[model samples]
Target: MQFAIENALPMLERTPQVIETMLYGLADEWIYSNEGGDTWTPVDIVAHLIHGEKTDWIPRTQVIMGEGSKTFVPFDMEGHHAVKKGKTMSQLLDEFKILRKENLAQLKTIDITEESLNRTGIHPILGTVTLRHLLAAWVVHDLTHIHQLSRVMAKQYYDAVGPWVQFMGVLGGKR
Candidate 1:
């Protein structure tokens, strides 16, 4: 996709609000429920988001822009959940809001010029990547979790939508 700060900033700015709109004040059943078993709950997704706000986006942006071609730290996807333990889902969402707000504030203070955006960093798995790629991925990452939240919620209606399961790919797929 095109690499423009114009495109990415709004998403970075609005993620917490979108998340709140999707999950604020939801009951524990909705927040913790998932399709059958062995999947992420909305609560888990929020914790993952909180972890990303702290560890992924701006920190990596700084590395790629400032350290150029340096091998970056690998992100621990399955880890970071310990932060969520003992917290209610509402607490998780509120914490994400604060963290995301702080990150967006930090992101705005940085100088993300075309040159900076073109700067590259070595990835442990995906090989070399650029700041442009990271920014784009950040937006897509938010979208992915939003879709995941929707799918998880939709699954609560899986049986209600009986025959439509064939048509509703979200309820049918192993997301």
Candidate 2:
């Protein structure tokens, strides 16, 4: 769990940097593409990350600390995307960065002893799960979405450069 939290810090920092460098000034049309087969826009991805930090990581940690309920509410990804679609990419990215920083700070202060690891919560879908499990999943979730963002970015690059760019042979196959 400590490893997961430590590893997540740099990735969290990189997320905002990637958004600002690669995704800034991109139109909503580019963001909301169907090219990725129902994959979310970059903005939606940011919102999902933010929401996960807020509704999943932080709250679950609070539950572990005995400051909140053990009952975990299942998240609605589609619903989150729908609500997030209204925001500009910059707004979403900013929110994600801020929330991630706050969460990281909070994580650093947590005491993850054997007792904390034994802390359990009632996940709406998975029934009861330990704090360690929750923390591990939080790290997994970050990695999963970072990979998702990379795929989306790759698709965008391929689309922008057109068919012949595929022949440029960086990826050695169809873009």
Candidate 3:
């Protein structure tokens, strides 16, 4: 299989754009709620994306470039939250956007050869995995978080507009 930069860059660019579009106009209170009792506030989700790019994707790419070892470092999302708790939602989102851009830039520089994709790395839990698997999973991770953000937004909309005609219209309910 061909490991081409052309195939990957567009997907990387789309991830942050999708998140930003999905999150437009949401209020701070709604964004920060623990609706599902999960520790991740909306800001935390943004922070998680930023942190994943730094800790997960960058290091993996370094390994692929033969500049670093494949030994994975465990990441604590809750620990990230504690550090990021001071940040405003917009702040976290801005930081995430910047980091995502950097990730895309770094990815573009990678020499995407079949041999590079086939290079193996030992993830602490998953054991050995190829560069392609890591890169694909990074995109999947972005999509997963985008879906999570959308779900939270949808629930907030449902709560705010419950069973009314306007709510029906908002949800594309036909008369």
Candidate 4:
């Protein structure tokens, strides 16, 4: 389907609530453990999402909208590790919710249109990108993490699932 602001907002707006619902009040093992070897735990994913909210989406949109420099600031992918150190998952989720709400509200205030969505900005690595591409990416980025969160959480039961492992794609094909 084509990207449309009307369709994108529901997914963007509901992402935090979906994340919070899936993760909040879970055991630490589910919240903090990873798929091993540098993969993110749910906590890390939440922090990364929070970081993207504060840095990537609307900020880049502003640049595309001609509100600031045409060239985008290079995003710090690992910057959230430091921010996550002292905070609990609950705190991170709350921060994400608030930031997303604010960003979506700010988005509503912008005079975005089909024509405007074609406006371009220079990505640090990818060269020129349109506003529509950025917005579509923002939605997909949220989805990618959400899928990662589910896969990571499911792997917590990887070994416990026993012979059913062959049926489970998330456990790396049953180890």
Per-residue lDDT of candidate 1, residues 4-54 (tens digit): 998888887888888899899887788989877689989889999998888
Ranking by TM-score: 4, 1, 3, 2
Q: Which residue pairs does candidate 1 place in steric collision?
A: none
- Segments in model 3 whose C-alpha atoms lie over 4 Å from true places: 1-4, 157-175
| TM-score top scorer | 4
lDDT of 4 by residue, 1-175 (tens): 9999999999999999999999998889899999999989999999999888889999999898876578999999997897688999899999999999999999999898999999999998999999999999999999999999989999889889998988887776744
Of the two candidates 1 and 4, the one with more favorable lDDT, higher being better, is 4
lDDT of each: 0.85, 0.70, 0.73, 0.92
Regarding lDDT, does 2 or 3 come out ahead?
3
lDDT of 2 by residue, 1-175 (tens): 3644456557655755665666678776666653366767667777777778678787777876786578876776665665486687778777877887888788878876777877898888889888878877776677677666666655667756676776644434553
Best by lDDT: 4
Per-prediction TM-score to the true structure, in the order listed: 0.91, 0.74, 0.81, 0.95
Lowest summed lDDT window (length 10), candidate 4: 166-175
- Collision count of model 3: 0
Between candidates 2 and 3, which one is better according to TM-score? 3
Q: What is the alpha-carbon lDDT for the whole of candidate 1?
A: 0.85
